[model samples]
Target: MRAYRYLDFITALFVVVLIVSNIASTKVVLLGPFTFDGGTILFPLAYIFGDVLTEVYGYKRSRRVIWTGFFLLILATLTFGIVNALPTPPDQQSTAQAFSAILGLVPRIVLASLVAYWVGEFVNSYVLAKLKIATQGRWLWTRTLGSTLIAQGLDTGLFLLIAFYGVWDNALLWTVFVSNYVFKVGVEALFTPLTYAVVGFLKRAEREDYYDRDTNFNPFAVR
Candidate 1:
């Protein structure tokens, strides 16, 4: 499959944002009545692109983008850990404090996040692409929402379990699990019409609508 030069650029920028957003996500802020993580805004955008990549381009291209994001996350996590380990200068105490607050994440938590992201995103792309074919390119809402529901469910449950399973009580873990799952999918569900609009616009603008009738579907092959 030939790459649209513009799409490749977007994918690169998207991966960078994914890394920075993961670090930024360590901080939380109140979004009116509810608390929201910084990553929430951009993370959903990534998934939307994940849907676009698979739906419009095919899973192979989406797989390449997913691997790019996965590696970038690993690199970002390692960079933060390394920088946090170094001793701080006497005058740089405040800088160190800020860095610790913003970028510092435990290795285990980072591992959990990486693992969850890799599996969740690929599954999302795969399911969406497959459904797109099975449905004969009909019911865009059903495929996008249905795949996100399942994919986000596994993502939330796995990440919470890996990152906070024993740290939080079972009830709290389950509470967070259910709440996060609902929130993520709710975010996608609320944006369903937007997804439809974007998909329609992209397909028309790009003049591409891939069915993946002959895709390799191998998770390991980057090509």
Candidate 2:
């Protein structure tokens, strides 16, 4: 495998975003008319990063990164669960309770996150890759936005239904689904220029603009 200066950095950031977003998702916040988990603010970036990775490095490399983020997120979720399960020192019982209150929902959240992320990201990468080939690498905006359109829909609906269906009332669930889906896709569309800059820069800097021609699209392929 060829080494690139920024791949590691991008992977690290992607994993961080995945883990932090899962943790932050414990809180349901109302920002004006928008009702969503705190994590929604950060989660859209994962898709954008997915777009950049596929656009520059191809789906195979993006698959590895997606899996990397997925596993690390599970590790973090397990760690939180374990830590919460441990006995709290008497002096720190209050803090422990607070921690439990905030993170107690992590298991379900992580499950939803893992499932949605695994499926959604692969689809995002796959769609973008195919779009790249279809357009002969023209109209980067279409690829990014088009992929986000489908993938974010799957992600938002799955995550909300899996994570909050019974826990939240139907109205709240529907509101969040609408809000999160719109926000995520809107964020991707809003970041088109930035995506363009990063994609162009990475392609130029790394001398790579990978197309998925003859590339395996299997999500489980090791290579």
Output the number of the TM-score-best candidate. Answer: 2
Candidate 1: C-alpha lDDT:
0.79
**lDDT (Cα, tens digit) per residue for candidate 2, span 103-198:** 765567777888999989999999999999999999999999999999999988988888888998999899889989888888998999999999
Over 4 Å off, model 1: 28-38
lDDT of 2: 0.91
Q: Which residue pairs collide in model 1, if any?
A: none
* Per-residue lDDT over 197-219 for candidate 1, one digit per residue giving the tens place of the 0 to 100 score: 87787788778888888988888
Residue 109 displacement (Å), model 1: 0.8
Model 2, runs deviating above 4 Å: none
What Cα-based lDDT does every candidate model obtain?
0.79, 0.91
Give the best candidate by lDDT.
Answer: 2
